[model samples]
Target: MHIEDLAVPSVNMVRWGAPKQWLFVTPEQENVRAFEEKCRETFPWRKQARRPQRAATHCSQFVRHANVLVTTEALLDWGIDFSETICREGELVVTLPGTYHQVVNMGENLAEAVNVMWGNCGQVQSTYVCCSRDGCGHTGGVSQEDLTPEVASQ
Candidate 1:
């Protein structure tokens, strides 16, 4: 459940993976809130850790729960509109900025991805916290002190 770099689009080529499932959702506040709520409900243990929301990266709890595969019925119940696709071998998947996405490999497979920034890139790099390339250390994006239940709720 993360957005790729705002300045770059992620291009993934499925060289061997067949039937890879890709899910995407447009970044909307209501959708994000619903997703976070679902995550919290799914993994109640994480509530004690007091970790800040790190939607930009596949962090611990979220990564574990991502395998649960939210059903289409649940998405509709939550009012979350999404798009999905199945990529097979020799297929290419392109992901644009500001779109939250998740991928599930149906079986063991190999794939490669690269990020490219072009003239049409819209958002500034600083708009979203990128913990992948930047030297943000292990603590994804937000600090622990910055996110309380109250702040996270808002």
Candidate 2:
């Protein structure tokens, strides 16, 4: 079939709606060791609204539906981590439906950004389960999953 032969419906057509969204800002995008150092950073971390990173380590969270992450400044990376970026006014990262990622504030302003999720119209499902002892507790989050290899092989 031709590329245009495939028929996928648009989210606006259905009354389903978009994914959840929120803005985030942090002081330093700390590594595993400097994790504690970030506590002293001057970003806003509301005690009640604090949601731990949803990955094996402190990485960015993925949105269930489609999302547009607009950063106020440039971003830094961790060794070889990869993400989708489109730079216009600032930098807009159009993340894969559900891909695991992390970010560092290469820019100056703490780290400001807005995320919009497209809920049901999104692609895969992601699961971040925390299985730690100390009876501290375990939790998991479901988002979309990555579809790179599956699409690339074709």
RMSD (Cα, Å) for all candidates, in order, is 9.2, 14.0
The candidate that wins on lDDT is 1
100-131 per-residue lDDT for model 1 (tens digits): 67788889788998875555454343434333
In candidate 1, stretches whose alpha carbon ends up further than 4 angstroms from where it belongs are: 27-71, 130-154
Q: After superposing candidate 2 on the true structure, give the runs of residues whose Cα lies further than 4 Å from its correct spot.
A: 1-89, 119-154
Considering summed lDDT, which 10 consecutive residues are worst modelled in model 2? 1-10
TM-score to native of every candidate shown: 0.59, 0.26
Worst 10 residues of 1 by lDDT: 129-138
lDDT of 2 by residue, 35-110 (tens): 2222223222422132442221232221211122433332232222223322233334433333233343333332
